[model samples]
Target: MTTTLIFTQLTIREAQRRKILWVGLLMGLVFLALFAVGFHYIVAEMDKYASLEEALTITGVLLTAGLYAVDLLVILMAVLISVAAVSGEIESHTVDVLVTKPIHRWQIILGKWLGFAILLTLYILFLAGGLMLIVY
Candidate 1:
């Protein structure tokens, strides 16, 4: 296979092997659970506050903030996953084998970056979908 393809596969495999991905997934789930509980409480309290319209307005704002928070978390995870992708390989001496091949250093770097970017995009999409389902 081409160097770029190899590098991309390696980067993705590395990210999958890391515990951080699982941790991030767990955190996202926890956040969703908390949001659900909070939403229910807000709805209950809204009955006491005044009109359902006003309560809905408040809920909408909170839900928007929650979505933004999820986006931020996904971004953070992307950066962490990408940053570690290269550094971890170097530390583990895996890069040595790849570099010894016919591949250029720049190709390796770019390939890994692309892989991480893809992973990040997938993560954000999933998180957004989950949030939308919860909000609706």
Candidate 2:
């Protein structure tokens, strides 16, 4: 296999070993659950006095609010993961082993980026899908 692919796999494995993926998934699920419960209650109460048009408008607003919160969480996760990915390795001197390898420096950076990008994409998709399902 290519060096970049190897590094990508290594990065993903490290994240798994650290349980970051599991923690993120658990947190996302909890957020979705809470959002779902709150949305159900609010819509039920709104239904009592609100017209159809008002209900639809309020639903849209609630969905948008949920989306905005998800967006912020995703952004925060991406920033935290990316910031720690390289710096932590360097601080722990793990970069020495990597540098001593035959792989080019750019390959390591690109591989780490690809790994984190894949993770973040999956996370975003999961959270967004959950929100959409709950709202619709």
Candidate 3:
């Protein structure tokens, strides 16, 4: 619905403006750094003694591991993001404006849900893509 879409966009905008978004991203970045280091060490060790096939096998395994790590990170980020969505807006008095608007209650809930769902999906896809690139 248009109402849902508007709220979704509003939620996205609010999320982007907050400092916690960056802090959450910072943690994800740190995780990526550690993943890169671990991956580098693993591949280095493989290159030292592994044959082409063996190295490739190890690479596949590590790639899957990286994906799993990204999965965990994205889920954690989702938790952090969603846990505060409604509560955050209400606490900050931003919802006062929305309350005065012609928006339906279900629209607000659906929009927030859609917003976070999209956000987490994109975040997971992005991290998964990055890890796959590294692995490949």
Candidate 4:
């Protein structure tokens, strides 16, 4: 438990130190910023549809497009982060230090996994919150 928590925290910190987390965060912010600009244009375009049904149709189309774009980014981020995480330290031979630790191998693995999970969660939450801001 303690080992897991420590590992998880370390993993998150490592990602930040390595700038992977920053890249994801920066990407998400860029996405949201672009979305905001697009949303403004969507609102502007909606003005052309004064009828209730037409306005709704335009909004639905625009919103769906925005969602699709976000979906692709999220998926890309997830895949890239996971792949890098699994092989990152190992490829650099940093895992050797952890192997010397008294902790069980499983605990070490679990800790690292937990850490990446937290990173991904934070990334997703940030993007989701941004999306909510755009929607609401």
Candidate 5:
């Protein structure tokens, strides 16, 4: 368990060193900004012509669409991160060091997964929080 935790910490540090977190954050912020501007214009237009109930329904639908986009973004990030992680290490021969170590291979994989999961959770929270703020 301690070994797994060590690998987990290493994986997170590696991601930080690569600036994956910063890139994801920057992209998420840009997405939120665009969503906010578009949502504002949509609400303004709806207010001009939509009844209260209709406006509320449309807003709900728009919010759902925005969430769907966020979901897709999360999926894409996970794929990009996971798909490259092991292969990238192997390609650069970095995995050789871990392979020779006493650690079980599963530990490395699990640690990477956990690290990426943590990152993705934070990413979703940030994006969703910003979206909610924009809507409400």
Candidate 6:
């Protein structure tokens, strides 16, 4: 219970402090714009194709590629965010204050990891949702 609370608080604080939200929003907008442009091009090309089946197949392939691209973006962001979490705090000496608390060192580390994990999970969900919106 204590660990969970600590993790939740840390995650909330990090989310409020970092540029993750803005970066995510911008990435999502860009992804949607790209998907739109890609879909338009695919549709045009499909019209040139001889068979309706071939057009649908090509469209499906393009959509799959877009979905994979979105997943890659999400994974990249997750790695970047997690990589920054502990190292950034330590570099800024923010961890020092937390270390002085009554909490154990291991608890602090675990809490931070859990916080980053939660953030990554949310980021993945957002990316997946955006991809679904674009594809469907």
> Which sections of candidate 6 miss by over 4 Å?
47-50
Model 6's alpha-carbon lDDT is: 0.74
Show where candidate 1 strays beyond 4 Å. 47-53
By lDDT, the candidates rank as 2, 5, 3, 1, 4, 6
Runs in model 3 lying further than 4 Å from the true structure: 90-100
TM-score of decoy 3: 0.84
lDDT for each residue of candidate 2 in 1-136, tens digit (9 for 90 to 100): 3888888888878777776567777878998999999999999999898999999999999999999988987887777667778889899999999899787899999999888888888889999999999999
Q: Write the per-residue lDDT of candidate 5 for residues 7-117, one digit (tens) a residue.
A: 788877877777666777788888999999999999999989999999999999989999998998888777766677999999999999999989899999898888888
Model 5, C-alpha of 23: deviation from truth (Å): 2.9
**CA lDDT, every model vs. true structure:** 0.81, 0.88, 0.83, 0.76, 0.87, 0.74
TM-score ranking from best to worst?
5, 2, 3, 1, 4, 6
Instruction: Kindly list the per-residue Cα lDDT of model 1 for residues 1-136, writing each as its tens digit.
Output: 3777877887888789988888888888888888888877877788897587887788789879988989888877977676766777789998899888777899998888878888887887777887777777
Lowest-lDDT window of 10 residues in candidate 1? 79-88
Best by TM-score: 5
How do the residues 1-117 of candidate 4 rate in per-residue lDDT, one tens digit apiece? 998889888877776777655787788899899888888887777787567788777777766776777778777776766677657778988878878878887887798788877
TM per candidate comes to 0.83, 0.90, 0.84, 0.82, 0.91, 0.76
Distance from true position, residue 38, model 6, in Å?
Answer: 1.9
Which parts of model 4 have CA positions greater than 4 angstroms off?
none
* Candidate number with the higher lDDT (1 or 3): 3
Report the C-alpha lDDT of model 3 over 18-75, residue by residue, as the tens digit: 7767777787778777888888898888888999999888888888888788888887
